[model samples]
Target: MPQPEDDPGSAPRAAGATNAGATPPDPATVEKLRSTIGSLSTATLKQLDADLPWYRGLRPDERSALGMVAQKGIASFVNWYQKPVSPEWVLSDVFGTAPTELTRSISLQKALQLIRVVVQVVEDHVPFLAPAADQAPLREAVLRYSREVAFAAADVYARAAETRGSWDTRLEALVVDAILRGESSDALRSRIAAVGWKSQARITVMVGSAPSEPNVGFLNELRRVTGRLAEDVLVGIQGERLILVLGGVRDPAKAYPRISELFGDGAVVFGPEAESLVAASSSAQAAFAGLTAARAWPGAPRPVSSEDLWPERVMSGDDTARRSLVRTIYRPLLAASNGLEQTLSAYLTLGHSLEATSRSLFVHANTVRYRLRRVCDVTGWDPLIPREAYVLQTALVVGRLSAPPAPPVAANGAPGTGNGRAARAGSIDKAPPVPLGRPSAL
Candidate 1:
């Protein structure tokens, strides 16, 4: 429908109608609102103490800090309403003064509750401060500003949480590094405590190749997998290698199969379990040495024990492996009194043939077999298996080299020329033979 042209005086009225809801508050009204901010802040604090359990539970200093925040928030709101809509001013003025650790003291939900109380207090005073016709637009602005405050609160908490997570990860990596490096300082213990390490539980280290691609969730996945087995883990990914310190494991060998898939494709080795983390350095040393030497054995198990790779470690000049071999296998066999050492030496020297070894030792084949069984019972290594025989043979050579030289004696109970071959032959001949029957039970 065509309309007649209106008077030019009505043009200003038309523009005022278009901008009605968007008009800024009068100078007198803005000053009156600012005058009420201090009282409003006090009322908001009272409301928080009366209604919010978390706020009421805060200590005196924390309560004081929160009170300051409330006062600043009220003052900031007054300045915000005076200016045109600027959310950045609210952030810098209201929340910027808040201490960084405020999030640690108050949760995001509780902070939102605080914001609600502040907004409600402000809304309750709106009718008294503004004319009835102006109240609706002021209330709408308050609601909009509250939403911005809520979003800013969430953003602050999100960034704080991310920072805490990153700091915890770095501290955990340092703790694992100290453990693997064999550092048992009081500082290390304190750091372990800081990281909430389970100190009393049994701890073992697992070493393997790191994944080619970085996975930020790798540690979480490791924890998920190990947690299914009722275990806790601390992980460190150092360059091409990944290390995990597993806790609360009664049997690492049993636990390895379930968690081996977490590691990348390579030789994964589990160190022996220590009584606690302080003593875990020995285990870590063995596992790391084994991981380095595991490639030597192409058929090594995916999650092989550090002890299982002792021979390879020794070959690779691992002093711990050499000492372990000497202590665990050689020393124990030497200390057992049933001529087990001589029998083992003969068994290996005679190409692992029971008949040849028996002939060499002047004992019945059954007796030789019985001694071999005793060796197995003592050392947990069966001579029949090629791999175990190799370990035993290596142990024998290492043991002989480590022991003091034996004094020379003649065969006929007389001092003789430096040869002990006849003495060794006679000693074998003079020993009592076992009955030719089923091998004696260990």
Candidate 2:
């Protein structure tokens, strides 16, 4: 069997030659070798000088001479020797301590030059060591190094993925909050940057509400459908509102209706096109403004866009303004005396029928004529004039619609009473009890 130093299984060392057949090394010689190597300077040249004694003491040439003897089996030992000089040089030249610290310091300029060449070799060797079937010791070393590198790479990928995901989630949340709050365009822009959104991509805004949990569930279903179409849409909640961010749309008209169909009759607003993320952020705010306008106005279909409703943008901020306009244009009839107001309201309601008005109010036909004439006298309103009547009727209808609903009551004052009409009409003074009695209504 080969001695330990000559065994292929042994770690490579610079002193393999003396161990072939000579007496095993004494402890003194081993200690001296170690001390000599440890004493070398960090300077590579000084290390090379220290290596000479370590190499010559090994008697490597004598070992090579002994290798020809077939019976001695020295050839095996000779063949197993590796790095007869280089391995020791690595331990000494690259890592040894120096007695004189000044001599150990390499010129910064020279160190940099050497480092460049060394880096190039490492880069070039990476591919060679990655493959299988290299020498067992070399392969094991390479694989262990690779495992360390792979672990580092995995850690980096995990960190990046987590960071990006967290950032996007926060971004979506901010957008939704802005939409629900009906924030201003400038505020929306500020929020976008605050959430670390990409400042360069085009952005689109959507505003609507999901009244119940089911509606939110519907929104998620709808989001999945849009995702299948490959549209990048982000969903988040703000207050009671649901806001969505859409991008990469070349044409909006095509996209708008599809969303409308998904949410029939629900309020939705889309903002105008924006060139960049900042612009899109502002545009989303504009769209929310459009939603407020739609809710305030008389007529707006779902998925309303800011562009189509520019003329009436003023109404979004001032709903009372619209109501005031309707009121001002028709106040004359509204403020008329109660009798005249009743007559006018009835005439308009019964479709200009004096008979119907009389029957409806439980009055004589002639009484309605008398009341109509009084209405004309008091307010100068004439049912005969179509234009004036039209205006008066519209005002009355709008006023009633705007007003609180009246309480329901029976026509009769109470049950089992023939005096209901008399009670309602109040008692006539009947000529103040004159000496000669007068008939009622006389």
Candidate 3:
């Protein structure tokens, strides 16, 4: 018997070689076994349906493929009994008889179970196939062949798993790339399903530097670790960057602190939660932007939220940060009444000094403190802390930038706001008065 190696198709050949020494049954017995191949195959299929609920649940084509495997195994056994040739032929002749889809659909354990059923059926029929004198050697040959096919089945599954892992890695990369690029399509959705992402509850994107010399095992180890942290996670390592799409994390810090330790020494940033993978593109963009912008905050935490790095992200010219700041702080303050926007603006601009802001706004210091408290209440950002104040200041700038151009001065000296349809009833039809120095042509 040839020694089994780690390479594909080697172990199976060794198994075939092991079967080489099994004494072939008598001609009458071999002929009977070969002739009854059809009946034995039928019995195996019937036993499969009766004994294995999972087999009955299989798609019709998959069940049919497994039946073919049984038929081929029996046929190969009879042929090997007569010929007893080299190792190369057995894998192709026995296990290879089943299609790739069969292996993919059914696990190695189930395949072994199928082998057991086939061996059992043949054993039950041995009495009819051969007389008592011929039965022992025939049973021994069947046992040897079963051992060989079992090893072959294991080898095929190992190879299939290796191939699948490689394919899933590439597919994950494609899905992550599509997310970062903001490409959503039927194809991308299908690819996500193929990659087996299950974090349907909440999706988040994390970006950081990649560890050195990350290999297949390195990624596999990460998968093992993250399998517990988040419900579903897709990991992609690009050049020096590592990106992860985490699903089902209500609070990333609680669920993901362990993951941050695994990242390369640098800032790790998590984007806001997204509703779905397609929507996660927005989160991915934000996380990438924060990672690029994280360097500006030397004192930033090991793992910081993208929202927390808005100041640096704004400096990096990230539109997401700009919009986020304007929405979260600028718009909220504007919407809240009682001079919250004005007081907060004064508080930040005047260097977080309550008295100075009160003096500038001609309000009581107590009132300034009250308005700052209200600012926190309305915007969920405190203007009291220097860092929070700086964020508020940036939000003010972004909000101002995002504001519409000063409504063009109207002829009647009122701000010409809104389209004509919503303007003063006659504004659209009224012609402008000619300039004082110019000729007023009719």
Candidate 4:
């Protein structure tokens, strides 16, 4: 049994003494050794089948292919022993029998294990085949040849790994592009599946300025950090912008600060969360729009939500932004109660003054306060908070703009007719009239 140090196919070592400075074996002895190489290859394969779990698990065809490699390795060693001074040609002659695809099927470590088994089998047979005087030198040659083979195997696998990495990177970029383009084709899904994207849901897209120079190291570090956070990220760099589609984020706002520094110096905006990657284009569109509109808000947070720039986005003719404001803020408040919407409008119109809004609407101050609270409950925006008040006011304006054009009023207060019947219109008509200096249900 080989000890750990004598593990024949560990890393390659510097070439030592050629045949331990002994005389080369005679031609007769070399022929005898060559005749036994076939048996040696067969025995090595049998030993691998018995001792190596991975070898035993290979399909019959794969095993046959690997057996050919072992036979070629044995024959190559015998050829190397004949000319011990030149071992450079031995690697190609040994590995040339196996196709490039074999490297993909078997890992480098397993290939090294195969080399070790063959070397051990050849070493064990050296004494039986070589003349007594040449046995030690023959064993020494086997060890040296094994070392060279190990190095050759490492080179093959390294090249294979590099190629695979490059291919995967390109495929990942394609998947991100498909997501951004909102193309949910079967081919796109297959491409994403090929890249092994683990997170299917809770996806968010973030857009920002890319660094001035290529920074592979920074991108790698960002990947490492997101991986540690159990997030899946697909990144793309287009001109000066960087886009990242992140998945499995429970709270995008909380995740932003950690990744903000990884972005280039500029406004970084996170889009709304989507249920899954298939629907992430909606999020990506919003983020891309926000990136274009972020300049409008000079005081925008470093990692602002795409929805936070709704006013700017709406102004920029983003129908999604206008519809989002109407759906999330205006519709809900409008459906809850006319009084809630009217009081909210009055408060904002009165500069968020409860007393002033009450006086203007003919309601007591307490009714205005109650309506304001209801507005907060309905819209998740408080009239008391300056920032939220601004959002609410913007939503009101956007909602009115997005609403259908009102029917023309006639002299009689009827829409498109000139009758004298009163018509309910605007906020004041929605609120019940309050007696002078008396509170009313808002």
Candidate 5:
């Protein structure tokens, strides 16, 4: 039932039918466009400067590169008008005229603005460049070419973003790994600069288990999220562990609760702040050490401070924790009022009995209570709390081991005989290691 006059055209005719009404510009007009490219470029640049507020703000060389782009686009349109083939060369013919670095200096939106300026300049000169009969096709050609340019600009920018994103991710990993290795090398410094790290002070480290289902997109989201909470951040996902180095967050009291839950099911640990990213190894080491020992304290708070795990870290052989125990507990108690240290020692060694401790020091029970409160204030650990007392006793042993006083001379001039070694606290008098157990009293 085919109608004899309803035959479709041949391949060439069908393909040519796509542009049936809008014709390619005549050779004379194409040659004219070629001749006027320079004028068109000048007009485009002037239009860009006048119409776009940000165009004048570009550096001289950057502006010159954009001029190259405008000139090349006009030339490309002239070439395109001859055959008016597919717009495949839009990327190379137009954007490729400028140096590769130009794309980085200019944004896609700004690129479109300049492309619009180029198209507008060509349209304004259409009457001068073409005869009365040729003006409509010339306008149509310019319109089609400008549409291709806009699409090409978007595609080029999208690729540039992906390339830059990948390079930044690798650079960030290298910097974080270098910090983990305690490297402050010149190359490391250069890498940090390349990563655009902003904070030069108060760097901190947080470590936890990586998610079971690892996702590059999740890491990206993490970087995006923390970038707001911190002045700078570095993220690394190595094997099963995820490490983060945050900069410029001097106090994370409010930020930690939200941040800690971002990690997987495990203890999250953050170390104290270091002065700079180069000095962040101290923080990283402490955080990693706490992550290793955090399992000891099953009920330890999520996202626990490395310093908060001093007792567990000490048990796990962290020398830094040992030194901290001596500094935080022993040294502070040594400089406190006379009775605080003795009261803590008596209270623990006397089975944590207030009455027994009052008698051991020959002080009233009310006096012992007062001293215990002072102990809590001095060391920030309460002797009345069972767990904190454990930490205090461990600190006592570490402190005693760190610096054991010399034996005293007796009245009869005998050395090492005045004070017996019987679990005394804060006395140059002899004392054994503080016991971890209590006498089953309050």
Candidate 6:
């Protein structure tokens, strides 16, 4: 039903309201609206300006406008003392003052409340640009208040952005350092998961061209693919390698093709499914071992995992076979110099006789004794026993195969002096390579 507009002659309702015919605003709703304005965080309020009406956005002229408005309100209110004026005039008289008077020290909460009131006054009746009568005190008060509120809002958002940026930078540095040191894949998976990463099952490692500047969106796409392909998957970087760990895969082999396509010509090794991250860590270790093998022996069409080479590792562990290999490889080195060879052969053959080999090498009894002792110390083997001799022989052959290539022989027909090889060949009677994890210097 239509309602009649209020007659001009009728008394008006209270201020901060629409026309009398308009539905009366609920007190609760008004309070809620006011609270929302008062509670707006500086960051959130700044966001509103992106799409808010022109009058709502921050403006350089806002301070002057506030000062003028406040001066006018206070002046009009005072002037009304001489003659009758509208209720708005009375409101200005009650509240308005110079903008300069509203100290910049006001809190955001207080500023927000003041701005809402200013907006309300403009909406109710007056244009913001209305000329000030003699209300200089009111204009100054409102101008100062508006300036303080705007400054508070901006200051809050700037502080929040700075805090967030610092956090993000620290996290990036931690991740990069961990990768280079070869951190376990499962740990990385757990971290990424807490930050909304969905991939926690199947794993593959990926290395980016510019890892320091990660494209989060692209990595996120990779995470999404793993989720669809496996139950839980995670991707991370380790040094130059990108590691992906897969968990709870229903058919690991079936998913391999898709991962291969995504990580072409990259170190994309996969791990076995496991019940938990600890199990996954073990599986990742196996994958890493396999990856090490693949790198050493390339030309395999597909990526391999550590589980694939368990048989070889086991077979290579046979004690008898290893002993035989040691004997075959080092017999020649022992046979090279007659004086040295015969002494070594006799020392091993006759149970390391300082007395027997002394007579055998035709040297002074003391000299034979001294050479045999030196041989034991040099090869890390007891010349009097077979076991230590065999162990040392095997290690020498293995060291030849695995150690870095001997530094090139020098132009003077001498091995380079600074490198380990030059040092070793310089004294053939010196110590051989020690066993793994035990320093040769010892």
Q: What are the per-model numbers of colliding residue pairs?
A: 0, 0, 0, 1, 0, 41
Model 3 / residue 428 / CA error / Å: 38
**Model with the higher lDDT, candidate 5 or 6:** 5
Candidate 5 Cα deviation (angstroms), residue 268: 0.2
Model 6 CA RMSD to the hidden true structure, in angstroms: 22.6
Which residue ranges in model 3 land beyond 4 Å of their true spot? Answer: 1-12, 15-25, 198-201, 401-442
Each prediction's RMSD over C-alphas, in Å, is 13.5, 20.9, 8.6, 11.1, 12.1, 22.6
Residue 297's lDDT within candidate 3 is 94
User: Which prediction has the highest lDDT against the true structure?
Assistant: 5
List ranges where model 6 is wrong by over 4 Å: 1-234, 246-255, 264-267, 296-301, 311-442
TM-score of each: 0.82, 0.33, 0.82, 0.86, 0.84, 0.32
Q: What lDDT score goes with residue 435 in model 4?
A: 61
Return the lDDT, model 3, position 377. 86
For candidate 6, the per-residue lDDT at 283 reads 55
Put the candidates in lDDT order, highest first. Answer: 5, 3, 4, 1, 2, 6
**Among all windows of ten consecutive residues in candidate 2, which has the lowest summed lDDT?**
68-77
lDDT of 2 by residue, 32-85 (tens): 333433222122223322433432333444322211111111111122222222
Error of 4 at 159 (Å): 0.3
Report every candidate's CA lDDT: 0.80, 0.49, 0.82, 0.81, 0.83, 0.46
Model 3, residue 62: displacement in angstroms?
3.0
> 4 or 6: which has the higher lDDT?
4
Q: List the residue pairs that clash in candidate 1.
A: none
| Tens-place lDDT digits, model 5, residues 1-442 | 1112233421111123135445556889878888888888888888999999888998998888888888888888887777666565667777774635667678888888888888989999999999999998888888887887777787788778889889998999999999899998899989988999879887899999988987878887887778777888898989999999999874588777677877888999999999989999989999999999999999998889998888899989999999989998999998996778778988999889999998888889999999999999999999999988999998888898899687886444567545434223235455567779867876
**lDDT of model 3 at position 334:** 88
Instruction: State the lDDT of candidate 6 residue by residue for 1-442, as single tens digits.
Output: 1113353642333332223243333344334333433223332344334333543643646634533443343333223322222332232232344322333323335445545555344333222222344234234433543443344334444555567556654554444345435565766655544433344444443222224444667577766876777766545554555556555556666766665555535444544444555335445555555555454435443655443333232244533333333453344345444455456666666665677767766677777766656666544455556545544434455534544676666646676646566666777767688668756694
User: What is the C-alpha lDDT profile of model 4 across 1-442, one tens digit per residue?
Assistant: 1113344654333466245566766798789988887788779988998889999898888888889888988887777677665444544577774646568569888999988998988888878888798888788778888987787787777867789889998998898889889999899879878988878777899889888885779788878977765468888888898888888976655678777777889999989888888789999999999988989999999899998898888888898988888999999988998588888888899887888999988999998888888888888878788877888888999888878987777555557633234443443468988768767779
